[model samples]
Target: MNLLSAGLVAAVVVLIALSAVAIIRADRPGGAWGRRLRSRLLLGVPWGTIVSVLFVLAVYLFVQRGYWHWTDPVTIPFRSWSYLYPTGWLTSGFAHAGPGHLRGNLQATIVLAPIVEYAWGHLPQERGSQSFASWRTNPWLRAFVLFPAAVLGVGLLTSLFALGPVIGFSGVVFAFAGFALVHYPVATIVALLVSSVISTVVSSLVDPIVTATVSASPPSAPSWAGIAIQGHALGLFLGLVLGLAVLYRREGRPSAARVWLAALVFAVVQGLWAVYWFRGGGTYVLYRGVGVALVLLLALLVTLAAVASERPLISGERSLIDPLSPLQTALSLALIVGLALVAYLGLGPPFVGSASVAVVITVALRILYTVVVRIAGSGRWAFGGITRRHVAITAVLLGVALLAGPAVVPNLVTVGDDAVPEGETVTVEDYTIAYGEEVPNRMVSAIDISAFGETTQINTSGVIVINEDRHIWARQVSPQQLAYSGAVRLRLGGVGWSESVVVRREGWTAVGNGTAYQVWLDAEDTPTQHAFDSAPQTATPSIDGRTVTVVPDDGEFYLGVERGNESLGRTALPEVGETESVGRLLFSTERRDGRAVVVAERGGTSVAVARHEQYR
Candidate 1:
């Protein structure tokens, strides 16, 4: 047997021996063996967490068809494209992008969710609370039903409010971490380490043996660049809200300092500080400084909100109905305005300054009128004259609102203008897929906003998909992405049906010049159509007063000899290691220097003209 196999076997034997030893040691009376299994489960096994994980897995395997095609699942229809697409809004949080995405989220969920569930507990912790006496206090009901139902509800909220067409259960996973962090900060961090170990084990099991070799890799963006920061923040706030409510009800407060430290570490490590925005044309900009500062502030605010005492901000003997002095009222108003401005501006560039001002004015006026009435008449003050806890909660909620409110403006938009580029397109149901270069990205441009040297009028090149009904005008595959990968398959569907559209790009790169390529769209039950053809590109090499050119015409590439726009002769490009003569120049293709090169020769003098790069 191989060395790895032998080691694995030995490890298994050692693990079995250790298990036997522990069981033997616990066999004595009053030992662990004497206790019921349920007693060790902290009220019961984490059935709710298990059920939640299973539900997400089932959606990926069955609903998204990851069962048949484990890596490439039907994803477009399941994304939260817009409010107009109810199916997408409902299923997006449950559906994942790919197998890797599903695995990563599930790994975190398996570790953190149990902690949150344990904190929730099967039986109520309230004074004199008895299990099974009431439905609210029933252990089985909480473990099997209530917890899972709450998770489902949170999933729906995340999907409905998340910006853009996001697909994944990652937001819910973050929620689990947030809630667990609030309850047991140190344990939550340890759970993160455990999660890493589990991930390593899974990876090792998936590939028991390893082989390494040098190879070219496809182009890819930074890992943190694609994170849905707004959605993640939204989920974290939601969890904090729920956790705080439970904490207050149970009168259990964790160490604020530990919570702050844990929150900071978790947020930074998990890329919650990776605040970024798309710059169109397959580019993204990250505001690292801004993101770090925001996360630090977020940690402090969360700590205060979760653990601060209910001491009134204002001192002295005063009833709830007592009128505040003009100075006090003025200071509160200024504080509100200051927070509003900071929060609003921090959520990007404020797409509509006038609208933002209007919102601030309207909200201020409503609150001002309410406060004036309460001061002039008799009623309980808001949150008992506003304690430190109330203020902290208000700040956190305001931050969440500012972060999430901007998403609504973008989500409310549809493809009202002509987003379909001027090119051959394949239509499936209400969707239109095409390939175009330098096409304006209507999605970003619709806001007509610019900031940090980035403008909304940016252009993009790639495979574009437009669904006016669903309010989707996305550049699915960028030019660089497609060039490196060579092909991409997209799935578009509605409630009960799905169809695939395969995009394949074939090109020949001219030496010292751009690529001459043709893009084809192959849809289900439809004949393959040539979608796009790039301009003819001339090679830098010259032979006998003629220049060899790679020309893409009518879905085929041809080798042409040209002399300053004057075509001497043209013929189909030669196969690899084969020759084709155009006029006095003989062109042949062969692999050299890890690239496919086309050489033009005359009188035994040859020069490499066009080349195609090979990637793994």
Candidate 2:
């Protein structure tokens, strides 16, 4: 929602309101085709808005040479035909026109224009001839086509996945609206008439489930390779059942079997969906069972709504299962709100005053401990001294647990891209996400400490991942902290700041021109100690590509412009007869006006840098 789009929406609202007044009051000439096409939407301002956004999006893509893309489409390097041997098939899809082009795809289900004709099937030329009560007719032709078109519009299918480039509104827009085909108790009107508050609340609670499923696996199975499987699959299932039911009802034939078949098909599709998701290294915990329940619920609702509309819609008209009633819902919400308030305020650990998942895990651990104790008491396995054996085993297990416990604590952790559904669009404390796109908003940031001390040099360079918004930002070169086991973490809170945090490890480098570098490390070598700057802790800087001993045994020191670059000549100290002369003379600098600046010192020796800049 930028400035231009906001203006467009406002304009549309005004125009649609005016149009609605015209159709009812002003003399309008629509008696046949024009009246039918108008439906209810045409008599409002939103329709005008739809027209504006569609027009802008179209203009942005086909013309203006990629209005919002990071670069021109033609300039995207990997997409060129010549690059294919080195690059794989994903080169095209991964290349986006710009943030706006990508953002449109993310908003697909919420609002994408309809297609001229849906890919799944057709709408009858005649209307009211299609009452949504019967099931044999095809209901989804418009919705199906619109979704793929929307997906393709953003290049999700065509450029990235193998099966498409079926991008655009044809799939998602239809898919979102397509839900009504199965749930056509005229949910919009009914929901509004009942209460906007309930509808809004229900939508909020359930939209995540819906978004999660469609994002996990879309319906166009062959095309969704390497994408979230469950989301797409559910979207496809929802669209299909809804569309078919509407088609059937309008054609005047409805069958219960058709609705049941929709569920069965969803189950079968889900099996394949799971296999693909797991094969691609996704967590089974994240995307299972949700899709099945959604399809069944949707299919039943579509059927019930079609049946209920003609008569007074009654609660007993369709059976409600053992459900968590409104009271329970309110109570549960209250409990969660309380917990969230405590956690967000940092009042205590998140599980404080709650019997949460943490409590469950703790109880399970306790149970396991009791079982183990009972077994140990029997002394069945160990022959001579069961007590001693148990003690030893317990000690070893405790030691291992203590050593590995940190792994379980996600106070800070890395989330692999495949670990969570991309659709969840998980947010970290430091950065914001572009909704469903899953593209990182911020990549790199760091800290600086050179201003603190004299003769304290902090030379650091390494790749570091840092939080941009939070204080967790990383820098290859900066003051940092180190863990010394000798100290207590609880007593100190955490390792306080030290000097020279290694942003990049020796082998791998940070990413940027002169900022990021590649670190080349062997598969199984240990990380080197990160250097720390201190009270002028004299250490050798490289000299002539060789490490110079900071203080030679003979009490001598060397000086050079840089440690490794040989172009700078070195001033070697003559062999000292005693330990009195081990340090080097210091150097200072001066501006052209003869004003002293950047003072430096070593061994009580100081020199002014009055030399020209060209001298270096």
**Cα deviation of 453, candidate 1, in Å:** 4.2
For candidate 1, write residues 257-277 as lDDT tens digits: 999999999999888899887
Off by over 4 Å in 1: 1-43, 132-134, 319-381, 494-497, 565-569, 575-584, 588-597, 612-615
Displacement of the residue 320 alpha carbon in candidate 2, Å: 14
Q: How many residue pairs clash in each candidate?
A: 0, 79
The number of the candidate with the highest lDDT is: 1
- lDDT of model number 1: 0.78
Model 1 per-residue lDDT at 105: 91
lDDT of 2 by residue, 341-436 (tens): 334223323234223423332333234333443433432221122233233323322222221121122112222232211221212232211111
Q: Against the true structure, what is each candidate's TM-score?
A: 0.86, 0.27
